[model samples]
Target: MFDVVVCKKKQEAENIYSFELTLPEQGYLPKFQAGAHIDVEVRPGLIRQYSLCNPAGKTDRYLIAVLNDPASRGGSVGMIEQVLEGQTIRISKPRNLFPLDENTGFTLLLAGGVGITPIIAMAEQLQQLGRDFELHYCGRSRTSMAFIDRLRHSPFAAKVILHCDDGDAKQKLNLDTVFGATPEDSHLYICGPAGFMDYVLGQATDSGWPEARLHREYFSAPDVASADTAGDEEAESFTLRLARSGKELKVAADQSVANVLLDNGIEIPISCEQGICGTCLTSVLEGIPDHRDYFMTAKEHALNNQFTPCCSRSKSSVLVIDL
Candidate 1:
């Protein structure tokens, strides 16, 4: 963890604020990539991940934008209301779960609402690399969008296309027109709310876009029911065996694997307990994991080698995990 101070803060849009964080001692921060994010300690025991929206190559400071979401479990509220400029806070080094495929011939960056955070960094990096890419930003309205003026005046402004729901119908996003025939060597990166992402992904899929070419990051877990207990009346009790300690713990039907482990004095690092973050992903040595996380792809879940213990349960009665 690094101790950084919020150097500056500005209201970007309605209920959205941007914070610039810099190391107190004046040293460069660890270099981060385009789609990297850092975990911030919002409160005593509350941690939340926010994407780096600033230019990627620059290491002097990290910029993050937060929206005061009404449905937030507390992260957004704490970040917007509690964190102040010049306040020192703890944050993890940048980690990139949604990294850009630099080798792709062309890129299509899409952002919805506050999901523009990571896409902004990606646009900067792509421009610096002289790569072919276009950015599509969609919002409810012009006033609700963050970084509108910044994007309009950016060097790559010509490559940006804005679509607002309240705008003219012709200017609205048409998924069919935006995504035509799939390009062989082009990739698509999308980030936004669950419904927005689902709509975009569903359209892309129906258009014959390959799963490998479609990339996305979710700010919150979707409302879809977990495949683990889709039709089941209730979750079944399971046994978790620690490989290193040879200790077995009973996971009750009403309890999560993470909480059960914590109750047994076994704590695993966890952030975003909703299963959107892969912080607590653990390898399964034996038995199958009833995967419930959006972090891992379906291919990874098919292997059943690792699972997010925070919200994922087990299919097998006796499951062994690598501690």
Candidate 2:
């Protein structure tokens, strides 16, 4: 667990707060490139990952912004209600899964609502490095979007297009021009809500853009009543033997495999039990894991035989869990 002091807080929108936290006068802090996020322990057992939006200029501080999602089942609501100025918090070192690769070709970035957090950092980095990129930020209106002030002054400000949905007279941007018959050197990046991401991805696919040229990240996990997931999900039940406990647990089709293992007193590291994180990753010795999470590639799931049980189930009847 790493410690951070809340150095500053600013309200970016009605319910959104941008927080700047700094390390102690300790010799040096872990340096993080753009598109990195830190897992903050907001409560006794709950930890949430928030992206670092500030540039690498501040060696002493890390920046994060939080939106109070009244509909959020977890941290957002609590972080909005509970946190105060000058509070101390524990955070994990930064981890980057969404990173900017070296390229001279024009880059297209799409951000939907609060998903702009990480992409904002990438844009700032690109601007400093004098890279060619364009960002499309979509929101209901300017009132709900964060960082309007900073984004306006970005070196790539002219390239930043704002698409406001609340009767902006005209749509500020369109994805068809960005993806349809795009150049071979063009690379696209997106981060947004599920519906928005799905639509953009579908359009890109229809445009015949190579899957390798398109990249996206979902802000929320897919376990929340998704139509893509099956209702009559599991066909058969199975037994999972924990390597740590040397005990077997029965899992029913109605229950998640992770729950049964946890009920049997075997602890598997988990965050975002919704299957967004790879924290619960475990090796499967004998059975096929019905892969569900977005973190693992198809090849990784097949070749590595590792599973994320929080949302994954066993396809085989009897499997040995490495725990």
Candidate 3:
């Protein structure tokens, strides 16, 4: 864990706030590239991931922006109203699952709401490298957009496009026009609300964009619709076999593997229990897993060697786990 002090905080938009963190010793912190995020430990056990918005290869400080969310479990509210400047906080090392693909000929960045964090970093990198790219930022209105002033005054302003819900139909985003002429070597990166992502992805797919060409990251895990819980009696039960200790645990139909493991005095580090954080990833020694988490890629899911037990279960009758 790296201890960093909150040096500056500013209200960027309506409910969005930007924060600058620096090491207490005033030395360089860890280096992070575009699309990397650091997990900030708000309280004792309340850890939330925030994307690093600073330009790539910079290590002097880390920049993050947070939106005040009333429906938040705790992280956003604590950071917005409870945490103060000069107070030190612990943060995890940088991790990136959404790194920019510099090999792509032309990059199209699509951001909705606060999803501009990573995209902005990518845009900065692209500008510095003189790569061909465009950033389309969308929000409810101009008052709700973060970093608008910065973008407008920056050298990359010419490549930035703003779209608001209050704008005219002609000024609004037309996914078809944006993606219809995309070349085979072009790639698209998206981050935003579930419905917005679905709409954008659906339109892109209908326009013949391949899955590999479209990359995305979700701020929150998509709701995993389970089969009817009312029919628990009809649901199938599974067993977990530990390879290390050779211990077997029976998992009920209505129970998750993590819950059953905890009940049996086995502890597994988990966060977001929704399988979005990849905190509880465990190795699968044997058996097929009914992959459910969005953390792993399609190729990783096909390998079937690792699984997040927090919400995912076994596809076979029994699963052999490393621990």
**Candidate that scores best on TM-score:** 1
Runs of candidate 3 with Cα error greater than 4 angstroms are 223-236, 262-269
Q: What is the C-alpha local distance difference test score of each model? A: 0.91, 0.76, 0.85
Question: Which structure is stronger by lDDT: 2 or 3?
Answer: 3
* lDDT of prediction 2: 0.76
Report the poorest 10 consecutive residues by lDDT, candidate 3.
223-232
Local error of candidate 1 at 79, Å? 0.7
Error of 2 at 53 (Å): 0.8
Reference-based lDDT, residue 244, model 3? 93
> Model 3 TM-score?
0.91
lDDT of 3 at 258: 93
Candidate 2's TM-score: 0.88
Per-prediction RMSD in angstroms? 1.5, 2.7, 2.5
Q: What lDDT is reached at residue 33 by model 2? A: 80
Residues 163-270, candidate 1: write the lDDT tens digits.
999999986998888777335567999999988998898888898888899999989988767555462257899999999999999998888899989998888999
After superposition, candidate 1 runs with Cα above 4 Å error? 226-233
lDDT of 1: 0.91
